[model samples]
Target: MRIATIGTGSIVDEFLQAVEQVETAECIAMYSRKLETAKELAEKYKIKSIYTSLDEMYQNPDIECIYIASPNSLHFDHAFQALSSGKHVICEKPFTSTVEEAEKLIALAKEKKLFLFDAISNIHLPNFKLIKENLALLGPIRFVQCNYSQYSRKYNQLLNGETPNVFNPAFSGGALLDINIYNLHFVTRLFGSPDDISYTANKHPNGIDTSGVLVMKYPNFISECVGSKDTQGMNFVLIQGENGYLHVKDGANGCRSVFIHTNDQEVNLNAQTSMNRLFYELAEFEGIVQREDYSSCYKLLEHTLEVVRETVKARTDAKIVFAADKR
Candidate 1:
């Protein structure tokens, strides 16, 4: 798959590393608002073309796929343009600012017969897959707790009366959308949508959540997802079941060391060998596009939609609003 990447953020560096490991995908072009930024990444990745304008990049028929790692506020517009221009899109997660934006993009992707992927890392990780395979061994799941907390460098800036995109409501930036979305995907992909969802947040002065706890109520189990940009801690996920429990030590974004423990024994499962967490998802995207597997794509899309719905509800109920929510 020939690809064009948007944005030259730190994530793009990790993405470029992942692309190097995938035999089926190569980034042919890069786009950035600044020509120097695009040139910098292109030189590092050996990409041939760099464009300052998205329209110029979209017009290139050689670019079969568009990888968007733009800001959270821009995901919908960037993805919509890619889908409309007949290019497959791998959008960075927090797929869009709102459920409505996500639905529209999914609809356009279906109409255009293009592959649309939310670039979530954990779902494609081998350890995460192993968790699903051994879930039955844990008997019936009773509770799940996921905590992904990192003290952002931008947090101090916010404290100093400055707003960074990650904590800024104007850019659809918040802890839930930024970090907790991974936990949402991790839990919802394994257990499906919850019966009820609610959020309690420590809001910034501008009405964005700096830290929050998302509580999801299932028929039999209660799941709590704690994400914070204001604080830091040891991030992990614990799934409790009737017979045993599974623990992930490296948080939801990268399921690095996973252990399953029961009364009988404890086993360590770390199946993912790649240091670059983005590689698994990029490889999966390549296979899906190669096989034209729209069914499987849509199945994942449905899961993403469910996540968007629940997260939107949580944000709304908690009175944490983004500029996109008004739209």
Candidate 2:
């Protein structure tokens, strides 16, 4: 498969390295708003070409897939363009500003018979899958908690009247959108959408949420998600049940190990380090593209849309609204 990636950032480089690990996919080009920046990465990766305009990139004859690592606000536009151009899309999360945009993209991808996957960084992790397999050992499910908080250098800049995409509301920026999104996906993949959601937010002086705690309630279990940009915390996941509890000290993504405590017995599981989640995600995407698995594509898209809806509700509870949602 011929692939193209859009963005000129450090994560984009990391994504390239991950994609490089996949054997079936070939990156055709890298696209950036700055032609020289895109060319630099293309040369570094031995890509066929580079283009400044997305229109040109979409028109490339050899391109069949696109990986969108652009700003949070640009995901809908870029993914929609790729789907319209008959290319599969691997979009970074949060997938869009609202559920409506996600649904529209899903419909478009269906109309074009293409794949549109939300490239959630956690779901593809080996340790996460192992955790799923080991859920039975923890007894009946009860309550769950996930916290992924990191102090951002950009938050300091935003406080000084220097607003960038990471902390600016115009670009749909906030700790909930940038960092907490991973926590949301982590639970959504395990338990699907919550029955209800509530949020406690720390609003920055600029009217953006710098940190927040999101609570999602289900029928039998409740979950707490903590995402932050203004402060750092112990990134961990704790799942408690009737018999015992499972502790994952390393958060949901790039997890290090899992420990289950039941009765007088304790079980420990350590995942291998070299198994990058992106490697598996890209390989699975390749298979979906080759097989025309519409059912699985639609199911994943529906799951992504559910997450978007829950996020909107959490933001609303915290009194956070992106400008586009008003329309």
Candidate 3:
């Protein structure tokens, strides 16, 4: 698939690198609010077209799809524009600021007969697939704990009365949307939606959640997802069960190493070899688009919508309100 990219952030760099690994996908055009930013990335990736205008990019007949890595606030607009212009979209995580936005985008994609994907890396990773396949080995699950906490460089700025987009409510940026969303996708993709969800958050003066703990209650077990930008911790995912337990050493974002432990046996299952986690999702998107597999794409879109619903509930319950929430 011939693709265009919407942002020039660090994540876009990672996506560009992953594109190199996916033989079926190539980024041909880049868009940025600033021409210099677009040119810099275009030059690095050897992309021929640099678009400073979204309208211009949409007008380009050569661009078949768009990979949106824009800020949280812009996802809906960017994805909508791409889809409305008859282009498939591979959107970054936290698909939209609200479930309504996600639903509209999904509907538009269907209306246009185009592919819409939530670019969640873990769901497509080999190790993640292994975890799902081996879940039976763990027997009946009792509890799940996922911790993905890192001290954000911008967190210090927030302390000194500076608001980065990552910590700003108006931009729909916070711990739950930024870091914890990964944990949500990982769990929901594997086990489906939870029976009940609740969130308690540590908020900045700006009313944004700097850190939070989300609890998802299932019929069988309770899952705790802890995500923090205000503090740091050892990042990992632990699943305890009746027979054995499964552990992911790295975190929900990247399943670097997976280990299964039972009473009598211990095994290390590391199926992911690629350094770039984004490669898997991009490759999967390429396959879906190439084969016109809308059935599979919509199934994943349904999963994304479920995640968005729970996310809205979590944020609302915690009184973490984004500007989009009012809309």
Candidate 4:
């Protein structure tokens, strides 16, 4: 997959690095509002093309896919344009600001027969798959607690009255979408959508969540997902069951390590090959796109849609509205 990227953020840098590890994937072009910003990243990665206009980048026949790492609000616009331009898209997570936008993008992808992926890295990790495979050992899950909290360097900027894209409601930036979404994906991907959902958050003056706890109730289990950008803590996931439990180190984002405790014995496991969590996801995208596997692509799309639905519902329940919601 010859990928072009449409952002100059740190995530874009990570995505480019991950592309290097995937043999089938290469980032050939980059688009940013400013050429200078994109130039730094392009030079670092040895990318030959950089464009300040989306039209120019999208017209390049050499660009087979567009990796979007824009702000949450722009995800829909960027992905929609890429898909309309006949390019496959890998949009960064918190896929879009609203369920309607996600649906529209999915519909367009299907209609155009193009691959559309939400750039969710965790669920595609080898260790994450290993955790899923061993979930049966836990025996009848009862409860799940996932916490992913890292004090954002941008949070200080927000505190100083600078609205960083992440802490700004207009940009669809908040703890839920920005930091804690990994927990949502980890629990939902393993157990499916919850029976009920509710969210409570520590809100800033601009009505964005600085930190929040989302509670999801299932038929037999209850899961609490805590995501915070205003604070830091030990990030981990604990899945308790009738017979035993599984402890996931480094929260849902990395799936760095797993420890299983059973009646007979206890075991620790880590199956990830690359330290860059984004590597696994980009590699998977490369294979799927190479094989033109729409069935597999849409399966992941369905999962992403369900997560977006839950996210929208959670936001509605908490009355945390974004600019996209108004639109």
Candidate 5:
């Protein structure tokens, strides 16, 4: 699939670097608000086309898909533009800044019969899929606790009066949207959307959450999510059941290995770090486009939108509003 990337950010750089490994996908075009930025990305990545305006890329007949790695507040706009242009979209996580925006994108994609995917790449990993298939081994699952915290360098900048994009409310920057979204994904992927959810966050003076603990309640068990941007925390996910426990020591976005500990035995998948499973997500997008399977992509996007929908609801119910929020 020939994809046009819509942001010239760090995530965009990483994606472009990784696309070299996924032979089925190519970065054919790039678009940004600045012509120099777009041209730099095009020249650096050896892409054929670059557009300073979003309208130009949307009008480009050669671009079939758009990958949006822009800030949270812009995700909906970019995805909507691509879908309106008769193109599929793969958007970065926290699907949109709000559930209503997510719903609008979902409805529009359906009306246009296009694919809309969220780039929560780890959900499609082989190890995660395998764990799902063998969930019975955990007996009756009781509790799940996940922690995904990384001290952002940008957070430090915000502390010293420099407004980095990560800490700026206008960019939809906050601990919850940054990393807690992954924790929500882990919970929702295993147990579906929660019966109820709440977030207790450490708020910054600028009205954005710096660090937080999110709670997703199930009828039978409790799932806890810890997400932060102020300070580093031990990143791990644990699933405890009647038998024993399952520990995933790695972070949420890239879980390389997992350990299963029962009363009598211990097992490890021995998943090496070398294999860049992110390639699988890109390949799946290409596969869907080649097969013209918007329905399949829609199913995934529905799950994605559900998670973000709950997150937005949780934030709203908590009365936590970012300055960037639209009334």
Candidate 6:
């Protein structure tokens, strides 16, 4: 798939590097507000085309797909433009600031007959697939705990009175959307949406959550997800059941390995061959587009919509509002 990437963030750099590893995908163009920034990434990735304006980038006929890694609040606008211009979109996770934005983008993609992907890598990882295959071994699940906490350097900037986009409510930034969403994806993708959702957060002065615990109540199991940007914590996921339990190493963001324990057996499984988890999702997306598998794409898109709904509801439950909420 020929691609043009938006944004020059660190995540975009990772995406470009992962693209080099995928034989079916190549990033041929880049779009950034700054010419120097776009040129730097383009030169690094051997991309020949760079545009300062999104409209110019979207007009390029060589771009079969647009990979969007813009800020959280801008996801909706960036993706809407791409889909509207008849280009497939691989939007970075947290799909959009609100459920309404996600729904509108999905509707546009459907209307345009274009592929729309939520760039969530964990669900597409090989290790994640293995965990699903062995989830039945745990019998009846009782509880799940997922922790993905990293002390963000940007948090320090916030403390110093500088509002980085990650902690700024105006940009739809918070621990839930930035980090906890991975836990949401891991749980919801495996068990579907929850019966109830609530979030308790440590809010900054500006009403954005710096850290929080998200509780999802299922019919039989209770899933607790902890995500923090204010402090560091042990990062892993534990799934408990009546029979045994499954332990996921490196948390939901990276299901690096899985430890399965049953009554009579214990096994450690790691099916992922590459540390670049982004590669798996990009390759899968490329294949879906190549085969024109709209059915499967929409199936995954529905799952993305569910995650978005859960996220919006949970954050609302905590009374943590973003600038987008007013819109």
- TM-scores of the candidates in the order shown: 0.98, 0.95, 0.98, 0.99, 0.94, 0.98
Measured by TM-score, how close is model 3 to the native structure?
A: 0.98
Off by over 4 Å in 5: 38-40, 270-277, 323-327
The CA lDDT at 57 in model 5 is 81
Which runs of model 2 end up more than 4 angstroms from their true locations?
271-275
**Tens digits of lDDT, candidate 3, 1-327:** 999999988999999999999988889999999988777788888999888889999989989999999989999999999999999899998799998899899999999899999998999999999999999998999999999999999999999999999999999999999999999999999899999999999999899999999999999899999999999899999999999999999799999889999987889998777989999988888888888898999999999999999999999899988999888
Cα error, candidate 6, residue 302 (Å) = 0.5
| CA deviation > 4 Å runs, candidate 4 | none
TM-score of model 1 (CA atoms): 0.98
Give every collision pair in model 1.
none
- The superposed Cα distance between candidate 2 and the true structure at residue 47, in angstroms, equals 2.1
User: Candidate 3, clashing residue pairs?
Assistant: none
Clashes of each: 0, 0, 0, 0, 0, 0
Candidate 6 per-residue lDDT over residues 7-94, each given as its tens digit: 9999999999899999988889998888898787888889998898899989989899999998899999999999889999999988
Worst 10 residues of 2 by lDDT: 271-280
C-alpha lDDT values of all predictions: 0.93, 0.85, 0.93, 0.93, 0.82, 0.94
Given candidate 5, what's the lDDT at residue 69? 90
Off by over 4 Å in 6: none
In model 5, state the lDDT of residue 198: 87
Residue lDDT tens for model 1, 1-327: 999999999999999999999998899999998888778788988999989889999999999999999989999999999999999999998899898899999999999999999998889999899999999999999999999999999999999999999888989999999999999999999999999999999998899999999999999999999999999978999999999999999788899899999987999998888989999999888898899999989988998899889889999889988889898
TM-score of 5: 0.94
* Tens digits of per-residue lDDT for model 4, 151-250: 9999999989899999999999999998889999999999999999999999998999999999999999999999999999999999999999999988
Alpha carbon lDDT at 162, candidate 5:
86
Residue-level lDDT tens digits of model 2 in 2-103? 889988887778778887887888898888877777776787888888888889889887898999989888899999999998888999878999888988
